[model samples]
Target: MAKKKSDGVNKSQAIRDYYAANPKAKPMEVAEAMKAQGINVTAQFVSTVKSNSKKSKTTRGRASAKKSVAKKPAKRATRASKATSEVSLDSLLNAKKLVEEMGGVEGARNALSVLEQLMD
Candidate 1:
């Protein structure tokens, strides 16, 4: 098993070295290149690191210009909604009974929790 390398390489170096010998290449392509050269890296990791660096700059560019934005408050569910959400005792009992029939105690407990949350 290979020990993981340091994540200390800045995005500039990573991205530059990645596409230096393989320009116009994608992140997955870069990851494969890293693997070929024996650098422990994943495609997702490459994409994430590259995007993370760009994200700050991208956010800054948008910050200078105003955009229509509103934070919508979460609404409390109505009594009717709550009534409909009530967990049926019969359903829970049936789930428990089925789990017991299948010799699945753990499954019964999991199902019971779902039922309990609904009941609350």
Candidate 2:
């Protein structure tokens, strides 16, 4: 077991290095290897350390120089027009029921015409 300095920072680096060296090694195996070298760590701890190392590495160089872009809001009528192109199964069933209640297909068409006028 190698003696750590005043702070225990090297343990995390050692764990990360072990993961790099044996990418397929299980968490328990990593813990046991650390145990052999006189550092006590759990499998969960190993997983946490590994994940944090990955996160830190990914975020290190990307935060400062990035620019935030303001996006414009989309037009509601355009979105609604796009939405009307596809009819879902539930909507079809409801339309069928409404047509039956109105006494037939012609009644449904008349109802739809009134609804379209109301929307405008």
Top TM-score model: 2
> Which portions of model 2 miss their true places by more than 4 Å?
1-9, 56-120
What would you estimate as the lDDT of candidate 2?
0.76
**lDDT of each residue in 64-116, candidate 1, tens digit only:** 32234453443433333454767566556655556754458787678778989
> Per-residue alpha-carbon lDDT of model 2 for 31-94, expressed as tens digits?
9999898888899999998888777453465353223444344323322245467766656666
Q: After superposition, how far is residue 101 of candidate 2 from its true place, in Å?
A: 57
Model 1, residue pairs in steric clash: none
> What TM-score would you give candidate 2 relative to the actual structure?
0.45
Cα lDDT, all candidates: 0.64, 0.76
Instruction: Please give me the total number of clashing residue pairs in predicted model 2.
Output: 0
TM-score of each model, in listed order: 0.34, 0.45
